[model samples]
Target: MTKTIIFDFGNVFINLDIEGAIKHTFNSFKIDALSEEMTAFNSFYEQGLISTKEFIEFYVENFPNISKEEIIDIWNFMLKDFPKHRLEFLKQLKATSKYKLILLSNTNELHIDSIKKTIPFYDEFKNYFDAFYLSHEINLRKPNKDIFDFVLTENKLIANECLFIDDNEDNCKTSKFLGIKTWHINPKTEDITNLFKLKSELFN
Candidate 1:
C-alpha cells in the first residue's frame, strides 16, 4: 500500500520554462552553450555547496558586462505560474490525512526567494506537506541516490510504500531503482489534480 507521496516542485506544481530559460541565459551571457565547469558550478549551487553571494560573484566575474540585478532576473526567469486548481487539489489531499505528503525538489535559494515573493500562497502550500526537502536547504539533489536515501532514512518511510512523482525522467528512474514507486508526470498533457484518477492502480 502506498503510504506516502513524494512530489517535485517544478513542472509538477509550478510551471517552468526550462528551455526558454536556457535560451535566455545564453543570450544574456553571450554564451553559445554552457561549459562543463559552468554546469558543475550550477549543480554545486543547487546542492547548496555555494552561497548566493558567491554564485552571483562568480557570474559577475565571468560575465563582466552583466549587472547583479540582471543576473538575478535571468536566474529566476524559468519559474512561471502556480495554478490555483493544483493547490486546491493538494489542499483536498492534505485534508484527507490519507498519506504522508512529502515535497522533494531540486531548487536553489534565488529561485525559492523569487517563488516566495511571487506566489501568495507559498507558505500555505508548504504547510500542507509533512516534510519539505529543498535541494539547497538539504545539500542534496534529485537523480543522486544520496538524496533519496536521506529522505527514506530521515522519514522512516518504506520505498515500496512511497510514490515519487517528478517531471524529470532520470529522477523518477533513480527513485524507482531505489524500490520506490514513481510517476514521471508529463506536464503538457497531465495535471497533478488528476492524480488519483490517473494513477488509480497505485492507490489500490
Candidate 2:
C-alpha cells in the first residue's frame, strides 16, 4: 500500500515553460542555445554545488554583454503561473489523512523567488507538506540515487510504501530503481484537476 506521496513541484504543481525561457534567453543574447553550459550550470546550481552569485558570475563571465538583472529575469521567465485549481487540489490532498505528503523539487533560488511573487499563497502551500525538500537547499537533485536515499532516510520511509510523482522521466526512473512507485505525469495531456482519481487508486 502507498502510505506516502512525493510530489514534484514544477509542471506537477505550477507550470514551467522551459522552452520559452530558453528561446527568450537566446533572443536576448543574440546567440544559439548554449545548451551545454546551461546543463552544466543547472546541474551545479541545483545540487547546491554553486551559489546563485557564482552561477550568475559564470554566465556573466561567458556572456559579457548580459547584465545581471537581465540574466535573472531570463532565468526566472520559466516560472509563469500557479493555477488556483492546482492549489485547491493540493489543499484537498493535504486534508486527506490517508497519506503522508511530501514535496521534492529540483529548483534554484531565481526560480523560487519568481514563484513566490507569482504564487501569493506560497507559504500556505508549503505548509501542507510533511517534508519539503528543495534541490538547492538539500544539496542533492532528482535522477540521483543519493537524493532519493536522503529523502527516504530523512523521513524514515520504506521505498515500497511511497509513491513519487514527477513530470521528468529520469526522476521517475531513478525512484523506480529504488523500489518506489512513480507517476510520470505528462503535462501536455494530463489534467492535474483529476488528481483525486490518482489518490483513489493509490489509497483505495
Model 1, 10: alpha-carbon shift in Å? 0.3
Judging by TM-score against the true structure, name the best candidate.
1
Query: After best superposition, candidate 1 residue 40: deviation in angstroms?
Result: 1.1
User: Candidate 2 residues 1-204, lDDT tens each?
Assistant: 889999999998898897898899889878786778777997999888899999999889887988998889878888877788888888887887778999999998888888888789999999989999999999999899999999999999999999898999999999999999888889888866676575457543
- Single out the weakest 10-residue window by summed lDDT for candidate 2: 195-204
Across 1-204, the per-residue lDDT of candidate 1 in tens digits comes to 999999999999999999999999999988899988889889999999999999999999999899999999999999999999999999999999999999999999999999999999999999999999999999999899999999999999999999999999999999999999999999999989999989988875
What's the lDDT for all of these models?
A: 0.96, 0.88
- Whole-structure CA lDDT of model 2: 0.88
In order, what is each prediction's RMSD in angstroms? 0.7, 1.6
